[model samples]
Target: LAQRSKAKDWTRLIYSTALSPHQIVRGEPNAADREKDEENDDDFFTLKKATDVDADSMDATKETYPSDQLTKWDNEEMFDSIRNLFITGRNDP
Candidate 1:
């Protein structure tokens, strides 16, 4: 039931995105049909101001547990029992 609900939500999201005004209109200017009285004015308009952003502020660092404190999953008996689960194991059920 949860999977169906999630699938429905995803389908709705995709459908809405595909049919949205942004996707339909695309790069066409919104005011293209406006009066051309200002055609002599050649001033260009930008949606956003261009600025140099600090690259150092975007660096991401991850904190990791020390090797000595890491959890180990090596067990001889368990390895022998589940060896078939590995990729190279025999394809028997």
Candidate 2:
């Protein structure tokens, strides 16, 4: 589950990378559209996700997404990924 969440985060980054100059710079979602967006919750990528599958049956799967699985990005590898990204819930880098 933890890994899925990680991948899910990365997937959002990948999708955000696609935008026309006009769409990105001048076209923005209006308040109503934004409110509607808040109501939509779909996972387009199966990357590190915070969701669980069936807990029974042969196809049942369990997933967990605690922050302790990986080292903090405050180290070298993270560099400045946060500056370009809007990560939430983290008290620190």
Candidate 3:
């Protein structure tokens, strides 16, 4: 990690190709393979557009964090007790 961080062009060292165990253990890129990889530079770092994942049927806001618990409690004193557990509420001056 340290060596990669110090490198001038650290991103060039990164390759997304899958390798077999034997190839990994050998730990060397053949000249022909290296040339081929260099030729197809655009294929390596190209990013695809993300698909819209939302179903659009459900109400996203209410589904995320239901405010029912906060509304039901409705007590400032109860909240004060919970707040004192944190550093901001520490009274030990």
Candidate 4:
């Protein structure tokens, strides 16, 4: 990974054509093989520099955490009670 970082213009977005060991052993050809035949091989791995985060879909591919007002239960309060079970015990007087 460090060696790839040395390249100044190296882009962060990455596209990879990877195959499982089983996929390779079964002689099932994939984009990797076609890439090799086309002289686009990069040390047996076909990787492309991605320009956009969601190039094809271009839709919002992110999720936002629930806001305080939207949350049903207070997470901190629940954890506090669970933690108390280890430090304090309930008994009948």
List per-prediction Cα lDDT, in the order shown.
0.50, 0.51, 0.56, 0.50
TM-score of each: 0.18, 0.19, 0.22, 0.17
Model 2 C-alpha lDDT versus the unseen true structure: 0.51
Q: Judged by lDDT against the true structure, how good is candidate 3?
A: 0.56
- 92 Cα displacement, candidate 3 (Å): 10
lDDT digits (tens) for residues 1-93 of candidate 2: 466444444444446766444344344445986665555546464345333344553543775567754556657666555654555435465
List, residue by residue over 51-84, the lDDT tens digit for candidate 1: 3355565555876787654434365565566668
Error of 1 at 26 (Å): 52
Q: Residue by residue across 1-93, what tens digits does model 3's lDDT show?
A: 455345534233235545543454454468997786566676766445333344665545654447976674577766676676788887653
Q: Say which candidate scores most in lDDT.
A: 3
| Backbone clash count for every predicted candidate, in the order shown | 0, 11, 0, 0
Please tell me which model should have the higher TM-score, number 2 or number 4. 2
RMSD of each: 15.2, 17.9, 16.4, 15.2
Q: How well does candidate 1 score on lDDT at residue 82?
A: 62
Residue 60 in candidate 1 has what lDDT? 56
**Error at 50, model 2, angstroms:** 22
